[model samples]
Target: MKTLYIVRHAKSSWKYSGIEDIDRPLKKRGIKDAHLMSKFLSKEIARPDVFISSSANRALHTGIIFCENLEYPLANLQINRQLYSFSDGYLVKTVYALDDAFNSAIIFSHDHGINTFVNKFGNTPIAHVSTCGIIGIKFQEKHWKNIKKGKTFMVEFPKNHK
Candidate 1:
C-alpha cells in the first residue's frame, strides 16, 4: 500500500511589497499554525518515508516545521521547483514519478492543485484545502504509477483543531 500525505502551505504574507509570489514568506499565524499542525500530525502518524516541498518560501518553511516536529532530518527534505506550481498537472506528475521503494510521501504544496488532487485521487470530496490543512490518502496499488482513487484516512485543518 502507498500512503500520501498532502499539506497545503501555511498562510503567506501579503504585506511584503515588490516581492514575487514564490518568495512570499509565512505570516505569524502561518508559523503558529504550522507548528500546531505539525505537532498534531507527529502524534497522529508515523514519520513518512519521504518529505517533499515546493521551492516557494512559504511551502518550504511549512515543510521545515513539519520535518522538525516529525524528527526527520532537515538535510533530507527534498525541495522541488516543480511543486511551486498551482495546477494539478505537476502534482499528478510528481506523484506518478515517485520512487516505488518508498511506501509513503508527504508533500507540501499549494492549491487548487491540492484540492484538485485530493478530490481526484482520494475517495473523499474536499471542496477546498485551506492554509495549513493536511489530508492523508492510502492507495492499494503496489506502484506509484498505478495508484488510483483510494481511501481518505485523515483530514486536519487549523480551524478544526483550534
Candidate 2:
C-alpha cells in the first residue's frame, strides 16, 4: 500500500510589490495556518518517509513548517522544480518517479494541478484545495504508477475540521 498526502501551499504574502509569484513568501496567516496544519498532520497522520515540495518559495516555506512541526529531518525533503505550478501530467510523472524506498510521501504544491490530480486520482469532485489544506489518499498498489482514479480510501479537508 502507498499513502500520498497532497497539500496546498499556505496563503502567500502580497506585501512585496513587483515580486514574482514564484518568489512570494507566506503571509502571517499563512504561517499560522501552516503551523496548525502541521500540528494536526503530525499528531494524526502517519509520518511520511519522504517530503517532496515545489521549488517555489511559498511551497518550500510550507514544507519547511510542516517538516519542523512534524520533526521530520530537513534532509528528507526534496525540492522539485517540476512541481512548481506543474500540470496534472507533470504531477503524475513526479509521483511515478518517487523512490520506492518510501511507502508514504507528502507533496506540497499549488492549486489547479493539485486539485485536478486529487479529483482525478481520488475520483471525487474536489473543487479546490485551499491554502494549507490537505487531501490524503491511500493506494492499494505498491507502485505509484499503478495508482489510478477511484483508488482512494479517504479524503479530507481543513474546512471539515472546522
Candidate 3:
C-alpha cells in the first residue's frame, strides 16, 4: 500500500512588489498556520517515509515546518521544480515518478494542482484545498506508478482547526 499526503502551501505574501511568484515567501499568518497544522498533524499521523516540496519559497518553507514538527530530517526533503507548477498534469507526473521504495510520502504544492489531484486521484471530492490544508490518500497498489484512484481518508484544513 502507498499513502500520499498532499499539502497546499501556506498563504503567501504579495506585499513585495517586483518579486517573482516563485520567490513569494509565507506571510506571518502563513507561518503561524504552518506551525499549527504541522504540530497538529504530527500527533495524528506517523512520520512519512519521504517529504517532497515545490522549490517555491512558500511551499518549501511549509514543508520545512512539517518536517521539523514530524521529526523528519530537513536534508531528506526533496525539492522538485516540477511541483512548482499549477497544472494537475505536472502534479500527476510527479506523483507517478515517486520512488516505490518509500511506502508513504508527503508533497507540498500549489492550490489548483492540489485541488485537481485530490479530485482525480482520491475518492473524496473536495471543492478547494485551502492554504495549509492536507489531504491524505491511501492506494491499494504497492507501487506509485500503478496507483489508480485511492481512498481519501483524511482532510485537514487550517480553518477547521481554528
Most lDDT-accurate candidate: 1
In candidate 3, which residue pairs clash? none
- Whole-model lDDT, model 2: 0.86
Q: Give lDDT: candidate 2, residue 70.
A: 88
| Residues 58-138, model 1: lDDT tens digits | 999999999999999999999999999989989999999999999999999998999999999999899999999999999
**What local lDDT does model 2 show for residue 69?**
93
Angstrom error of the Cα, residue 41, model 2: value is 0.8
lDDT of each: 0.96, 0.86, 0.95
Worst 10 residues of 1 by lDDT: 83-92
Please report how far candidate 2 places residue 130 from its true position, in Å: 0.6
| Candidate 1 lDDT | 0.96
The order by descending TM-score is 1, 3, 2
User: Model 3: what TM-score?
Assistant: 0.98
Tens-digit per-residue lDDT, 1-162, candidate 3? 999999999999999999999999999999999999999999998999999999999999999999999999999999999988998887898889998999999999998999999999999999999999999999999889999999999999999888
Candidate 1 residue runs with Cα over 4 Å from true position:
none
- Estimate, for each residue in 25-121, the C-alpha lDDT of model 2 and write its tens digit: 9999888889888888888877898999999999999999999998999987899998986577778988888877789899999888998899888
Clashes of 1: 0
**What TM-score would every model get versus the actual structure?**
0.99, 0.93, 0.98
